[model samples]
Target: MKSAVEILSALAEPTRLAAMRLLWDGREHCVCELMRELGASQSRMSRHMSVLRNAGLVVDRRDAQWVRYRIAPDLSAETFALLEAALALSGKPQRVAA
Candidate 1:
């Protein structure tokens, strides 16, 4: 269970916030795909993912040689509401790499 501060802190960064919004659709995404979509380097994307994961806002699974990430399924109602609010605030559509 993550505290509100931890969750907010994790999302305070631009990259992490964008990553979370990208994952809000409930689809798992490959790190490489995220890298391309965000125009971020692999290392930078991984670090941002780490912050989301550590904050319990996302979950990662090993898929062969690649790691995939998605919003955590076990989030509390408050966390879900917070995410929803954030998503609502990000009115612009995210360009997810296909």
Candidate 2:
């Protein structure tokens, strides 16, 4: 479990917040996909993902040469609710996997 401060701090960045919102639609995203979607460099996206992972907000899995990320399944209701609130504020469309 992560402290609320830790989670909030991780989400405070625009890139990290955007990444979390992308995962909110219940789909795992590969680093490449995220980089393309965010128009961020690989190093920037990876660093943002690393922050989310360290905050326990997201989990990563190895899939061949790709590293995919999703919201942590074990998140507490409070934490999830916080993320939901953030998503609401973001006003971004839900991502649908194709």
lDDT of each: 0.85, 0.86
Query: Compared with the true structure, what per-residue lDDT tens digits does model 2 show for residues 36-78?
Result: 9889998889899999999999999989987999989898988
The digit string of per-residue lDDT tens for model 1 on 1-98 reads 78888988898898888888778778999999899999999999999999999999999999998899998989899997777776667673543432
What is the lDDT for 38 in model 1?
A: 95
Q: After superposition, how far is residue 52 of candidate 1 from its true place, in Å?
A: 0.1
Global CA lDDT of candidate 2, please? 0.86
What is model 2's C-alpha RMSD?
A: 2.6
Which regions of candidate 2 are displaced past 4 Å? 92-98
